[model samples]
Target: MTLPFYLRGLLLLTLIGCGWLLWQDTSDDLDSAPTAVVARPTEPAAPPSPVAATASVVDLFPAQTWTPAPPPTPVDTSPPKPPPLPFTVSAQWRFENQSKIVVLHGNGNQYTLCNRCSIPGRIVPGKMLDAHYRLDKLTDTTVVLTYMPLKHASTLRLDTH
Candidate 1:
């Protein structure tokens, strides 16, 4: 499937970031100073101020403890699956126009050809068929029946064998 331009750009940026992170070094400079040597200062340091050894505590208790109610059960909001494909290759016959149309239909969908009357199967318009063909092959004479959702309209390919 063709990826959108934005998605392709995002993937490219991710790959570049990963490559940079993998090759970059993060070590600190050890030659600059040693911890023991740096601890010995040339000048004397000032004394720190005195602080309380322990903090005072105050007790304030609630008369009753209330438990929070559990969150409401999550509702299922997913969309229902589309109906199954209805058409099957009951028989393959060569039309007189020297073209072949694979007919498919579902319980509610109807299949129709450019020239022929609406067949018993699901009828998808031409544009939707084009989108399906973008990722699949339907030219083989061997009828492969499958469930397909008709979502749009376009010109059907009559020349496909």
Candidate 2:
């Protein structure tokens, strides 16, 4: 025969409940509990040191003193003795194609000609032959004396003190 429907239902339900409880219990048991830990002690130390000295020192006295310098003065150039030769005599007559003349007779009797002789006026010394025909006399320096004329063949040199 068969259980009445209601009862069957109840039974099924109870079984299911019990199965679930059992599964729960097993799962709980599998989870582990925590463990506790204890302590330990440690160690120490070290030391080292010292180094010194780097040196410098200097001093010695002596600073400058000394003197000497002086000498220079002497000068007289020598060339101012040439003004006296303004003519103690001077003469130059040249012609060989005619033209080269200088006639100066100084010492205050003054005569001059340097325009190449054809002497006609302005060459004193009694107008010297109206200017040239003979005035030969060269070099007599107490400061200049010179002359020339040998038919006008020019070139004469004389140096009588």
Candidate 3:
């Protein structure tokens, strides 16, 4: 009489698989079939020119050799400069007698300087271990001192503001 429900389902699945395989086989055969080619008219080839036949091969852009640049020159790195002058022109003023005075402060001591003169009591205001200083020039806002033995000049500016 009749197959069970599970057997019927299995038979239906087998039939579907066989049909799919047959379809794939026919598609492969269609793809492998020869295709027809249509002929087209072709132009006759021209003979090569005599100049081109005699021309030698030449490279328009030649290969270049790479070369590394020379090492950079050594910088002239001089030693660190010495510290600045310790003395500063603290105050400057002119007396009624036309005498210019410059007050210098250094090392916890105040030394009063006059134009073309050393500090009172002959104490050098800008004295250092390596250099001695003498009052060189005086201006309204600047005091210039000459380094002794070296003759190097240094200026001290007063902060008026």
Candidate 4:
């Protein structure tokens, strides 16, 4: 026969052969056997090593883990205080070459007394002036009066203002 006829016959035979194979019974194979198929595991087989020096959750978020130090302790930022205020002196005069008695003009009065004087005695102020206080330090311009029992002191100056 011709080459074209032979080629056409070959093509027709190939199509018929493929169609026959596809139409054949796969039911026989299904009834024959079923091979096993294994499933993969999702987790690791071993635990992590502690000595590996792995990065930690803290390391991942250093900013979250970090904390700022407390603010520095507050410094004392007030003036050296004027001496404790108990009483104030307006003027004072010491007897010539004598420390025993001093003449003080204050609180609109003249008081004559020794270094240590008690309440209702000197030119001291307040109803509590009965509380005794001693002259701890005295100058021409100022006087430091100290309560002997309490050890608390007040500075009195020449100018009440």
Highest TM-score, which number? 3
After superposition, which runs of candidate 1 have C-alpha atoms over 4 Å from their true positions?
Answer: 1-65, 94-97, 105-161
Q: For candidate 4, write residues 24-73 as lDDT tens digits.
A: 75656777768898989898688777756464534655555467888999
Q: Residue 129 in model 4: shift from native, Å?
A: 4.9
TM-score of 3: 0.37
Question: Model 1's lDDT to the true fold?
Answer: 0.45
TM-score of 1: 0.26
* Structure candidate 4, residue pairs in collision: 119-129, 119-130
Q: Any idea what lDDT model 3 has?
A: 0.69
Kindly indicate the candidate among 1 and 3 with the higher lDDT.
3
What tens-digit string does per-residue lDDT give for candidate 2 at 1-161?
A: 99999999999999999999999998887775445667454644433222222223233564656655446666788633312233433655455755444554554555654433556654422223322233433222211222223233222343432
The count of residue-pair clashes in candidate 4 stands at 2
The global C-alpha lDDT for each of the candidates, from Candidate 1 onward, is 0.45, 0.46, 0.69, 0.56
lDDT of 3 by residue, 1-161 (tens): 99999999999999999999999999999999989999775977788888787676577898777897789999989854434677866777666656467677766666676644534553333443234666766666677777666566777776554
Candidate 2 structure, TM-score to reference = 0.21
Candidate number with greatest lDDT? 3
lDDT tens digits by residue: candidate 1, 1-161: 99999999999999999887765533334444456544568888867534432234334783665888789999999864544333444334456654455654434443433334344543332324322421132442433323245432222232333
**Between the candidate structures 1 and 2, which one is better when assessed by TM-score?**
1
Task: Give the candidate order by descending lDDT.
Answer: 3, 4, 2, 1
Badly placed stretches (over 4 Å) of model 3 are 1-82, 116-131, 148-151, 159-161
